[model samples]
Target: MRIKYKMVLLILLPMLVVIGAIAAIVFVQEKQLAAQQTLVLEESLLESKRAEIMDYVSLARTSIDLLYSSGRNDEATKEQVKAILRTMNFGQDGYFFVYDTQGLCLVHPRQTELEGRQMWDKRDPTGFPVIQKLIEAAQQGGGFQRYLWIKPTSGKETDKLAYAVLLDRWGWMMGTGIYLDDVAAAKAKISQESDKRIHGVMRSLAVTAVLAILIVVACAVAVNLSEQRSADAKLTAMARRVVTSQEDERTRIARELHDGISQQLVSTKYQIELAQFQLPESDENRAAQQALEKGLDGLGDTIAEIRRISHDLRSSLLDNLGLPAALGQLANDVAAHTGLEVRVDVSRCQHKLPDTPAITLFRIAQEALTNIVKHAAARQVDLLLSSDRRSVALTITDDGRGFAPEAETYAQSGGIGLRNMRERAELEGGSLHIVSQPGHTVLLATLPLSEAG
Candidate 1:
C-alpha cells in the first residue's frame, strides 16, 4: 500500500479495535440489565398472584362465618369451595391450597377431590414453621416472613414462596407464590438488545476509519501533484534562461568583431596604401624608412586592438599563463574601468586545481567584478581566491551602494548579470551565494575541484 494508506491504517485500526471492545462491554452490561429487569417484573407478577390467592381464601373464611350465622353451612357452602378450587393452576409458576385449624386441607387446587387432605402440624415451603406458627402469631400480634427452600407439594419437588396468616375462628392458614421462570425470559431479551447496539457501534467505527483513510490518501495525492508541478516549472524557466544567455553571448561576440576589429582593419589597410602612394619610388632611402615606420606603427595599433578583443572573447591568459594570470588581468581591467581600488589574494590558489573548478571560479569572479564596476558605483572591492584539495572558494566583496539582489530587475538584464553567474556555477555542479545590503555586497562561489569542471 502507499504510505498514506499505511498511515491511515496505523491510526484507525487501533481506534476501531478499541471501539469494538467497548461496544462489546456495553452490550454485555445491557444484556445483564435486561435480565435483571425481567426478573423484577416476574417477581412483581408473582407477588400480585399471591395477593389474589390470599384474598380469595380469606374471603372463604368470612363466607363460612356468614353461612353459620345464616344457618346454611351445608350443601351450598361445599359448592362455593369447589368453585374457588377450580380457579387455581396448582403447579404453574403459581400454586394455591387451603387447610383448617385441625391441619387438614379443606380445598386443594390440584387434588381438590381430597378436600380434607393435609397433615399441617407442618412446615412452610421453605422448611420453616408454617400453619402452627401463623396461628400463634394471630394469638400474639401479627407479622410476615420471607425465606428460601419452601416445599408445599408431596411426591415431587416444589421450590415455593408462601405467605401465611392465622385463621381466627374455625382455624385456617393460607399463602400463594409463583416460581422464578419469568426472570429468565427478561434476561434473554436484554442480551438480544445489547448485542444489536454493540454491533451498531462497531459498524459506525468501521465507517469512520474508512473515511479517515480516504482523506489521508487524498491529501497525499494533492501534495505530490503540487510538488511535481513546481519542480517542472522551475526546470522549464532555468532551461529558457540558459538558451537566452547562449544567444546573447553569440550576438555580443559577433558585434565586437564586426564593429571594433573588422572596421579598424579596413581603415588601416587603406591608410597603408595611401602612405605607399605618398612615398616617392626613386628616393629608395627615404621611401624605405617612412614606409617601414608607418607599417610598424599601424601594425602595433592593430595588434593591441586584437589582443583586447581576444581577451573579451575569452581570457587568452587562461590558455597562456593560467587562472591566476587571468584574474590579475581582471583586477587591472576593473581598476581601469571603475576607478575603484581592486585587490586580489592569490596565495591560496598557487597550487593548481581541477580545470572545470578553476573555470567556474574564474567566471564567477569575472561576472562579480564586472557587475561591481558597472553597477556598484563604489570605491573599493576585495577579491579573495583560495583553494584546497577538495574545493575552491572565491569571495568578492564590494564597498558599494548595494542593491537588493532579490529586487534587482536587471540581474538577468543588461545592468548586472548575476543570474548568469549563478547559472554558470550551477551548471558546473556548484553554488554561488550572494549576501548584499545597502552599502555592502558579498558574493561567495564554492566549486568542488574534486568533482566538477
Candidate 2:
C-alpha cells in the first residue's frame, strides 16, 4: 500500500474504534436509563390515579354520612343513597359499588343485574376472589387492591386499581376503581418518545464520528503529499547540481590541458624542428646543442604538466599506496600551495577499505582542503582517519576564521563543494557532519562497513 493510505489508516482506525465504542456504550446506557425513567414515571402516575380513587370513595362515604346525619335512616334513605352512588360517574368505567360483608352485591351502578346477588366467591381470570378481596379491604378501613375486574364501559375483564372503605353503621362496603390499562398506555407512549429521542442522539453522534475520521484522514493525506513534494524538489535540485559539477570538472581539465600541457608540447615540437634545421653538418654536435637542450627542458616541463593533470583527474598513488598514502600526498600538496600547517594522521586506519568508499573519503578530504585554502584565513589543519571492525571514520579539523554557521547559505557561499562532498559520502552509505565556530571548524565523515564492501 502507499504510505499515504497507510498513514490514513494509522491515524483513523484507532480514533474510529474509540468513537464507535463510546457511541455503543452511550446508546446502551441511554436506553437503559430511559426504561428506568419510564418505570418511575408510571409509578408516579399510578399513585395519582390511586389517590383519585380514594377521593371518589371518600365522597361516596360522605354522602352516605350526610343522609344518616339528616335523620333519614329507613328503606327510603337506603334507596336514596344507592341512587346517589349509581349517578356518580366521571369517565368510562368510572363508578361506585356497595357490597355487604357477606360478599352480597347491594349497589352496582354499571352492573345492575348483579345487585342483591350473592357474589362472595367471584374470582377474576387469575383466580383471585375479586369480590372477596374488595369486601375485605373495605372492612379493613379502606385501602387499595389490584385485580382483574369487568370494566363497565368495555364489558371486558381488565386490570383495575380500586379503593374501598367500610360503612360500619350500615354493614356496607363501598368502593370505586379505575382501569390499569390506561396507565400502561401512558407508560408505553413515554417509552416510545424516549426511544425516538435517544435514537436521534445516537445518529448525530455517528455522523460526528464519521466527520472526525474524515478530517483526520484529510490532514494525514495533506501532510504526506507535502512531504513527498518537498522530497521531489530536493532530488531535482541535487540532480541539477550533479550535472553542473560534472561539466565544471570537464571544463577545468580542458583548460589545464590547453593552457599548460598543449602549449608546452607545441613549443617543444618547434624547438626540435629548429634543431634539425641547424644540425651540425660535420657531426661536430655543437651547432644546435643549445636548441636541443632547450627542447629537452620544454619536454620536461610538458611531462610535469601532464602528471599534474593526471593527478587532478585521479591519483595513481591512490590505487597503489591506498587511501592513507593518497591523503598524505594531498596534505603535502595543500601545505605547499597554501603555506598552511597540515597534519595527516591515519595510524588507526591501517586496514585497506573497499575501492569506492576509499575514493569517496579521499574526495571529501580533497574538497575540505580546497575549501580551507579558498575560504579559511587561519593556517593549521588536521586530517584524521580511523577504523574499527564495523565502520571507518575521517575527521578534518582546521583552526580558521569561520563563517557564521547559522547565516550561511549554500547558494550564497558556493554550495557545490559542500554538496558534492555530502553526496559522495551518502553514495558510500556514509554520513557527513560539520561543526564550525570562530577559529575552529570540524568536518567528520563516518562510513559503515558491510561484508561485501
Candidate 3:
C-alpha cells in the first residue's frame, strides 16, 4: 500500500478499535437495561390486572354474603343465591362458578352442561385436575390459581386466572375467572414496542460510531498533510541556501585567483621578460637581478595565498597525519592568528578513525573554532577530542558573550558554516550539540567509529 494510506491506517486503527469496544459495551448495557425495564413494566401491569380481577371477585362475594344473611337455613334462599350468581355477569365469558366440596359442579354459568356433574377427576391439557385443584384452593379460604379451560367466547382451551373462596356455612365453593390470553396479548405488545426502541437506539449508536470514525480519519489526514508540507518547505529552503552557498564559494575562489594569483603570475612573467631583455644590455644587470628578485617574492606570496585557501577547504595534515595531528595544527593556527589562549587535549583517543568520521569531526571543530575567533571576543578557548572503540567525541568551549539560540533566528542567520558542520555530522550518523550562556559556550560533536582496517 501507498505510504499515505498506511499512515492514515496507523492514525485511525487504534481509535477505531477503542470506539468499537466502547460501542459494544454500550450495546450490552443497553440490552440489559431494556430487559430490566421491560420486566418491571410487565410486573407493574400484571399487578394492576390482579387488582381489577380481585375487585370483581370481592363484589361477587359481598352480594352472596348478603343473600346468605337474609335466609341462612332456607333452601329456596340458597337456590335464589345460585340464580343471582349465574345472572351476575360483567362481560362476555365473565361469570361465576359454584361447586360442592366433593368437586361436583353446582353452577357453571358459561358452561351449563357441566352443572350438576361430578368433575372430581376432570383435568386440563397439562393433566392437572382443574376442578379438584379449585376445590382445594377454595377450602384453603381464598386465593388465585392458573389453569387451561374451554373459554366460552372463543370455544378454545385458553389460560385462565381465577380467584376463589369457600362458603363454609353453605358447604360450597364460589369463584370467578378472567381469561389470561388478553394479559398475554398486552405483554406481547409491550415487548414488541420495547424491541423497536432498542433497535432505534442501536441504529443511532451505529450512526454515531460512523461519524466519530470519520472525524478521526479527517483529523489524522489533515495533520499528516500539514506536517508533510512544513517538512517540504524546510527542505526547499535548505536547498536554496545550499545553491547560494556554492555560488558564493565559487565567487570567492574566482576573485582570489583573478586579483591575487593571476596578478602575481602576470607580474612574474613581465619581470622574466624584462630580465631577458636587460641581460642583453651591457650595464643593466643589477636592474634585471632586482626585477627577478621582486618576481620571485611575488611568486612566493601567491603560493602562500593558494595554500591558505587550500587549508580553508581541507587540511593536508588531516589526510597525512590523521585527525589528532590535524586538530593540533588547527589549534596552533587559531592561536597564532586570533591570539586566543587555546588548550588542546587528545589523550583519550587511541585509534585512528575512518576517513568520513575523521573528516566530519574535524570540520565541526573547525567551524566551532572559527565561530569563536570571529564572535567570542574572549581570551581563552578549549578544544578537546576523545574516542574509544565505539565512538569519537569532540568538544570546543569558549568564554564568549553568548546570545539566545532561538530556532527561527538561528535558521535564518544567513551563514551556512554552522549548518554545514551539523549536516556533515548527521551524514556520518553522528550528532552535534551546542549550548551557550553568558561567558560560557560549548560545542560538542559525537561520531561513531568504524572498525580499524
| Candidate lDDT values, in order | 0.61, 0.76, 0.73
Measured by TM-score, how close is model 1 to the native structure?
Answer: 0.38
Which structure is stronger by TM-score: 1 or 3?
Answer: 3
| Position 47, candidate 1: lDDT | 55
Consecutive 10-residue window with the lowest summed lDDT within model 2? 282-291
User: Which window of ten consecutive residues has the lowest lDDT sum in model 1?
Assistant: 62-71
Task: Report the lDDT tens digits of candidate 2 across residue range 1-453.
Answer: 998888888767876786688678877876886788678767866865875686566546544554644445588998888899899887877998889889989988788999989999999899998888888887777888899988877878888999988877778888899899877787788788878867887887789777777777667643224645865676667665654565455446556665655565566557565655665555444424543555457556655656566576666567788889999998998898779999999999957787667777877887788778888886899999998767899999999987654453641465346756776777556898888988899989998887654
Q: Assess candidate 3 and give its lDDT.
A: 0.73
Arrange candidates, best lDDT first: 2, 3, 1
Best by the lDDT measure: 2
Error of 2 at 362 (Å): 89
Which TM-score value belongs to model 3?
Answer: 0.44
